[model samples]
Every structure is written in structure tokens, then in C-alpha cells.
Target: MPCLARWLVLLTLLSHSAAQENVGIGLDLSVGVEGVLPSLARPANASRIFHGIVFDAGSTGTRIHVYTFIQKDPAELPLLEKETFQSVKPGLSAYADTPETAGETVRQLLRVAKKAVPHVEWERTPVVLRATAGLRLLPPKKAQALLDEVEVAFEESPFFVPDNSVHIMNGTDEGILAWVTVNFLTGQLQAKTKKTVGTLDLGGASTQITFLPKFKKTIESAPPDHIARFDLLSTTYELYTHSYLGNGIKAARLTALGALGAEGLERKVFESSCLSRKFREDWSFGGLTYKISGIPDGSTGFTECYKEMLKVVKGVIHQPPELQDSNTFYAFSYYFDIAVEAGLIDERRGGMVKVQDYSIRAKEVCNKLSMYLATKPFLCMDITYITCLLKDGFGFKDETILKLTQKVNNVETSWALGAIFDYFQNIKIH
Candidate 1:
């Protein structure tokens, strides 16, 4: 049999058996639903293919992920066949006042989905959009308006549009889903294993840290919302997860300038030690723009930048005791981007570096500010903040290693994949 045909047969069998076991199809927010997985039985045929479209409406950009999966057998999880990913700039938050334009962005990305999935399967492919901190930061009414606009676009698209498909995801759910994505893609969730790596996601408006707590004290000492519990593949996991708003690299930039949450942006010129002395720019975030520049007639360098970052991160972030010890963490998004720009990691393959490495690089970059200022002025601030965030904020020892990466197993590292998994298990039989 040809490769495609053989795979189809296997998938059909798996889907059939999964249906018989009452597993049902679709992703579920609640883990291990009752009667979800019973004893598997052979089906009449074994060839099934499905597709899921997930839009990550992040603070900085809106990204579309088209995922294809094939179920090989009832007893096992579906295998990912391929992924098609695309992104648009300025994020959905930028369209706060013009939600219709945000919806248009969604409409444009759906074209990619239209081309990726088979024409016959277009109507069957489920499409979902989950906005993160960007929309969450917006006024409730404005956020709802933007989501409603996106829903209208999804409804008009030639794909399966589920109810409540467009909404702002809570920070806790965001962290949990990202943890799932990293663990699942890294093969750490297979065979009921206990070993799992942690995840650190640095976005434009917020940052998330998630890991399984091994000690009871860690969970006991944590604030109520700082901890989350969920089950994946019949195993319950107690995870320490938190998303810090206004702490993302971009937001941190504002905080360092004393512009975050400040009123009357029109007359204010926020100064920071992070930028080059001569560097000045119009920075925009979360639907607001500001004039930001380095301290004029004042100091600018690693020392000054570190102090500015300290005010933004120190004592603002909860430092769990567990982080002091050695732990494996996968850092992505801005974490990966800055590392690659600093020549600390391979852009394509990624690489590992210790917490101290960021500190070292920040010093090197900040010291030679004039040389790199022409091209990447924010390099000094970004690296310095990341170093502070990992060390003083998260309480990671200087020796703690972080695997800076953009993707795992060729899949982009983000919560979107985990959201896809959740979407699949929740597919109702009706």
C-alpha cells in the first residue's frame, strides 16, 4: 500500500476504536471527562484525517496555526501529520478602536487555512481564536466587541466554527496550555511519565512561568491563583503557573521608562537608562503609543539599565523556592529572539545557555552600546531585563540552564498546540 493510503487505514481504525471507547472527538478544557476513554474496540475500517485551526491572538501579533492529525489506533493519541503557521503584525489589540480591521486580519489568515486543508474537509475543520493578554488588557466591552467581530468572520468562513470560539483566555489557562504544548511536543507526556520540563514564555504584554511542583511546600506557600491543577492523558498534574501582566519585554520597556499605566501619554517623554544616549523612538503597545528615550544628560549603560529593570521586576514577581534549584526550562518567544540576536544561540536550531549567560551578554552589549545602537537599540534593555527576570525575578540561580528555542520537533513552541489538543477532545458527537 502507498504511504498515504496505509496511514489513512490506520487512522480510520484508530478513530473507530476511539469512538467505540466513548472517548469522543474534540479537545476538552476539563481533563479526563467521564466516559471519555473506555476499552478500545476495532472499527470497520481504519483511515481518518482531521484538521484544527487555532489563532493565537497574542499581545504583539495574531498567529494562525493549521494542524493536521492522523489517528493510528484507538489505544493511542492521534499523531500530528503537519502544521501550517502564519502571523500578522501589530496584534489584535492594535485594532481595539477598529475591531472590524482586526476581524479582517482573521479573515486574511483564514485564506491560509483554506489552502492548507483539503477542499472537501474545509467545512469539517474546526477553527478557533483565543486572545491572550492583549485583549485581556482591553476594557471588557472593547474586548467583547473585538471577539464578536472575529466570530463574525469565523462564521462566514468555510470551516467548522465552534461556540465560544472567540474570547480572551485567562492567564492561568494560558500558562497551563503552554506547559501542555511544550511537554506534549517534547514527548514528555507519553507512557504516563512523571518527568516534565518547565516553560517560560515571554511575550510583548505578559510573561508566563509554569512547572510541576515536586514539593508540597512550594504549592502550599504559593498564592491561590499562582497554582493550577489539570489532567492530561489520565494523569493529574499540580502545576505552579503564573502570568505576570506588564512584565513582558515590551511592557517592561515601558515600565523601565516609568510610562506603564501612566496617564496622559501625549505630553510625557519617558526616559530610561536602557536605550542608547542618542536613541529615541515612538514605542507603541496595548493600543497606546509613547515617546521614549534614554536618559538625557544622565547615565546610560548596563549598571543604569539593570537598576531600571530592577524597579520593574524586583519584588513584583513571586519567587518560588523551587526555582532556586536546578530545573530544566524551555524559554521561547522574546527569550529566543533576543538570544539569537545576541549571538548566544542559533536562529534555526536554537541552543542552551545558563542564567548567568544572559547577565554576561547584557553587560557586553550594554558596554558597547554605541556600536550596536544603530541597528538594535533595545538590545541592551531587552537582555538586561531578561537577565533580571530570570535571576532576581524568578529566583533562578546564575547556573540554572535555560533551553532557548523557537520550536520543538519542528513545531512552534506556544500554547496554540495545546489549545488544539483541547479543541479536538471537546468535539461533540452530535
Candidate 2:
């Protein structure tokens, strides 16, 4: 049988067994189950096969994820076949003044979805766009305008566009969704499983740390927003999650230079010890450009960079006491990028590194600043900031090991998949 026909036959079989039992189908990470809500239950005749399009409007870029899923039976969550992922540079927030242009980016990426899903299923495939910290940092009017333009473009598409499909996602949801994605893809969501890994996502404008806390005091001591409780399958998880805005690698560079919120970049020049004495560059972010360079008169190296980064991290990040204990964490995005570039992990296949390893590498890379600058001028600063962020900012002990990976089981480690799972739960298939 052909692919579509075979899938349809499988759906028929699964739908017939829909009433057997409830299995994990993901959950709204931001919302707690107040005694088992109806939305949590799988529909009696839920479709076994489906597709979803999720657009991650991150600070540095916009990425499209087209997912194909199949439920083995109604009692279990849908299994992802594969993800068609593509990204474009200069995120939606970059088009603050040209909102329409941001919409065009989404329109262009939708082509990937068009080619991936079957033509007959186009109208049933739900498409959504979730903007992250980039949009959240923009002016209210500008952010709304960008979202509005994207909604218009989504409406023009043949795929099904749900209400409020394009909007800025809250920080808490961002952290929670990412946690769900990592745990689910890692098979930690299986029933009666206590082993779960923490997730550390280092984006361009913000970073998030999320994990299921083993200690009750961890939850009680955490700020209300940092603690998210939700049920999946038959188990309830209280996750210690928080997104630190303006702490991302790129943003940290700005912070280290003391240029994050400075207005009128025309006359002001920001300097930092993180850069080499001869280094100078004009970097742009969040619709603003600034002239930044190294402090010509001051010293530059791992020691100097660490001191500069300390000002950006110390006392700013809430260090959960439980984090100091040994635990497995999967770090991705810029974390994976820097680890691979710094020779801490393999480029194709990721490896493990400890918090102390970053410090050791940062010192080694910084001491030989000339060689490191030849390959990547910012390596000194990037490595130093990462070390501080892991050790001082998040309060991870030097011995804490982190798994640096770009993908888990071939699926990219991101919140897009988890968001899709949540999307299907709230939508009614007519």
C-alpha cells in the first residue's frame, strides 16, 4: 500500500482502540491540572495520524518545524515520524519597523510545510507561530504588529490556522515546553520512570533551565513562577524552571560591554575586556546597532573576561540550592555550538563535559588569545561567559557534567515538538 493509505489504515485501527486507556500526549506545561480537566483527555475518535507546523521566532532567527506524528493506539501518545526543520536569519523582532517583511519570512518558510505534508491533508494541518524573547522585548505595538502581519500571512496559507496562532510566548511556557520536549524525546515520560534529565537551552536573547526537582524544598523555595506543576500520562511533575532574559550568549556580550539598554549608539562606543586589544566590530541586535571594541588600554584574557562576565551574572541569577547536587543536563543551542567549536565535544556526535571543563577550556583558549582570535575573535569571550554562566550564574558545581547535544534520537532538541503535542490536545477535529 502507498504511504497515505497505509497511514489511514493505521489511524482506523488506533481510533478503534481509543477508549482503552489514556497515555502520555504531552501537557500544557504552564497550567496545572486542577482535578483532571476535560482538555487533558484524548478524544474518543482522535486521529491517529496528523501533522503540525510550528514556527519558532527566536531572537537570532526564525525556524520552521513540520512534524508528522502517529499514535500507535488511543491509549498512547503520538509518535513523531520525523521533523522537517529550516531556519532564516534576522528574527521577526529585527523587523520592528518593517512588520510586513517579518510576515514574508513566515510565508517563505511555509513552503517547506507545503512540500512536506500531503496536498490532501493541507487544510487539516494546523500551523502556529510562537515568538520568543526577541518579540517579548520589543515595544508592545511593534510586537503586536509583527504578530498581526504573520497572522495575515498564515490566513493566506492553505493549512489550518488556529486562533491566536501567532503571538509572543511567555518565558515560563518557553522553559516548560522545552522541558517537555527533552523529556519526551528521551523516553523519560514512560510510566513508572523516575529518571529524567534536565534541559539547558541557550538561545540568543534568553536562556532557560528546567528539570523535575527531586526535593520538595526545591519547589517550596523556588519563586512561584519558577515552579510549574503539570500532569503527563498518569504522573505529576513539579519542574524547577526559569528563563533568564538578556543572559543568552549574544546578549551577555552586550551586558559584559555595558551596552544592553543604552540608547543612541551614534556617539557611544562600548568597550569590554572580553575582546582582544585589537578587536573591533559593529554588532546589531533587537533593531539597534552599536560600535563595540576591546578596551585598548586594559588587559584582555580569561581572567579579565571572567571578571567582566561576573558583573553580568553574579547576584542576578537565582541559584537553586538543588542544582549543586549531581544531575544530568542536556545543553543545546549556543551551548552545543560553543562546546563543539571549543573542542569540548564532537561536531557530528556530541559528548559530555563538566562545568570545570568549560573553565579549563576557557582558560586554555584565552591564554593563547592570538590563535583563538584568528579562528574566531569572540571565542575568548564566548567561552568565558559560558563558563561563568554555568558555574556562577546557575550555581553548578565544577564537577557537574552536562551532555552537549544538538539532537536526541535524530529529532532536534527543541520545544517545537512539545508545543505541537499541546496544540493537538486543545484543538477539536471536526
| TM-scores for every candidate against the unseen true structure | 0.89, 0.87
> Candidate 2: misplaced stretches above 4 Å?
1-48, 74-76, 426-430
lDDT of 1 by residue, 8-92 (tens): 3333332442343445443232333332332223453564467889999999999999998866654455688888999999899
Clashes of each: 16, 0
Tell me the TM-score of model 1.
0.89
| lDDT of each residue in 1-430, candidate 2, tens digit only | 2223333333332222222223343332233323211232467565445678999999999999998886555444458888889999999989999999998999999999999988856776779999998988888999999999999999999887777788788777888788788888888875447789899999989999999887889888888878877654545677888899999888998988889888788889998777777777888998889898878888878898899999888988888889989878999999999988899999899999998998999998887777855568888888899999988888999989899888888888988887875564431211
Task: Name the best candidate (by lDDT).
Answer: 1
| Candidate 1: residue 171 lDDT (0-100) | 82
